[model samples]
Target: MSGNTRGITREKALQLTMRKCEWCGTAIVYKNAQAVYCSSRCRVYAHRARNNPFAALRNEKRWVLWDTNKRPIMPSGAPASSTDPSTWSMGHVVNGHLNIGFVLGDGFACIDLDHCLVGGRPNEAASEFLKSYPKHYIEISPSGDGLHIWGTADEGPGTRRIENGLSVERYTTGRYITVTGRVFQPGNLLPL
Candidate 1:
């Protein structure tokens, strides 16, 4: 009965049984007769991951490209119309360079694209890649049709190796790949 004891008494264990997931508040039950979570889903939700603000921003369509003053920058060179989905692309400011590229996938109408390497519009080369894929990720090529999409080996179809003169690491699921032509490495990415 003492609080310092390692194990709980049967009565206390029954009293402490969780009724819901601690993270998402989903219903839970001790099916194994000694378990805390009803299912593995609740356990993973409770302890597997941390909240990410960038991911939250990606989910919400409120993310925008603005200057330090919060002034929205018009996407220059964007197709006047959505006539050819292939022609539409996004730009991001990367390393002070405006490396514009088109986005691929649904629900990305409001994602801002700036230069990924220099912090401006993507150059003509990167923009061409965007025009080709129009999806979340793509490959960079010598000619057109090179969209360098950054994704992990687990979630998507194909995997390509990218070298930026830095050590490459193993890929994992749920990593954030920005349309700005940069892959947000889990630990390397700045905390939101």
Candidate 2:
């Protein structure tokens, strides 16, 4: 014991401090400090709990679109024909010069975060914002600082909330995210 009435010792406390799963209370050891759940199932359940119980039909895959001058365009550098991938090209004319969008239809949406990046990492405010939805597919935008959060949010009109260091935009339909597969946090598809 480390001078405690309950006889709890420093050794015991140290062992319990970082090795327990936050969801199931199981003992675990993780090399990554961000790990919390003991298993993906627990993680999934916890993630689903944060969302509304609305059922959504998910599409299997999505195509990336391109745009510039804040006017969205297809990957072929032409005006987007439809939100569906079938109507657009997946290749960009000037890869780095062009802004991008992801076709958002068939029950899909995304949360976009910009300007919350510092030295290839998200700042405290961005990290805090992401914690609210831990199970969504998080991708680092081509800008290397922005973030794209893809999931099954409602097809309601897009909404944007901006802060001093970050801008958060959400879109449900007729919106395509600039495509990048650089996953920061890998998890199953999110649902609403």
Candidate 3:
């Protein structure tokens, strides 16, 4: 065998004596009895691979209300009554409201919610609606049993108008609303 071939065989023999690479799962061959990696290139590739998944998820165009940590503050109990002014408080509004649609920076729109719970339980009617419509909608207060059905304004066929005067504007402290049997202003709701 050539000198390089002989060296490789010797390295392979030495590698059989030790553990393999943790990242690539390749055996580490030692020609000089002290090799750490099967190849130097493999070491560099493994290092870069660690951060690639996170980067890819961020770059994708999707509606994600929660941060990368996946921590969402959910509310408990029934929804506020329409006539109650305290229901619109910040604390109640923040935790009680569900993210129905998102507006992308590029002006493109995407729907996020696939399955949502309504009226303190998964809404069979809404679930059926999704099965038939295949559209995205979010339920903020499943216990109260209301769904915030929405899609990107740019992508939606048209605007949604609720007879109760429901809107998609950001919650303000002055707005009167009710949540969980208690009446409060917008200040009572939790921030997203």
The list of candidate 3 runs beyond 4 A from truth reads 1-57, 60-102, 105-116, 133-158, 161-192
Better of 1 and 2 by TM-score: 2
Window of ten residues with lowest summed lDDT in model 3? 183-192
What global local distance difference test value does model 1 have? 0.33
- Ten contiguous residues minimizing lDDT sum, candidate 1: 183-192
**Whole-model Cα lDDT of every candidate shown, in order:** 0.33, 0.63, 0.32
The positional error of residue 71 in candidate 2, measured at the CA in angstroms, is 5.4
On TM-score, the leading prediction is: 2
TM per candidate comes to: 0.23, 0.56, 0.21
lDDT of 2: 0.63
- The full ranking of all candidates by lDDT, starting with the best, is 2, 1, 3
Clashing pairs in 2: 101-176, 101-177, 102-176, 102-177
Q: How do the residues 1-192 of candidate 3 rate in per-residue lDDT, one tens digit apiece?
A: 436655566556655667676444567644445555566654543443343211222332222232223322223333432223332223323433443112232212222222344434545544554343232323343224343332222222322332223322322221211112211111111111
When 1 and 3 are scored with TM-score, the better candidate is 1
RMSD of 1: 15.7
Residues 153-189 of candidate 2 have per-residue lDDT tens digits of 5468888887655689988887767656678777545
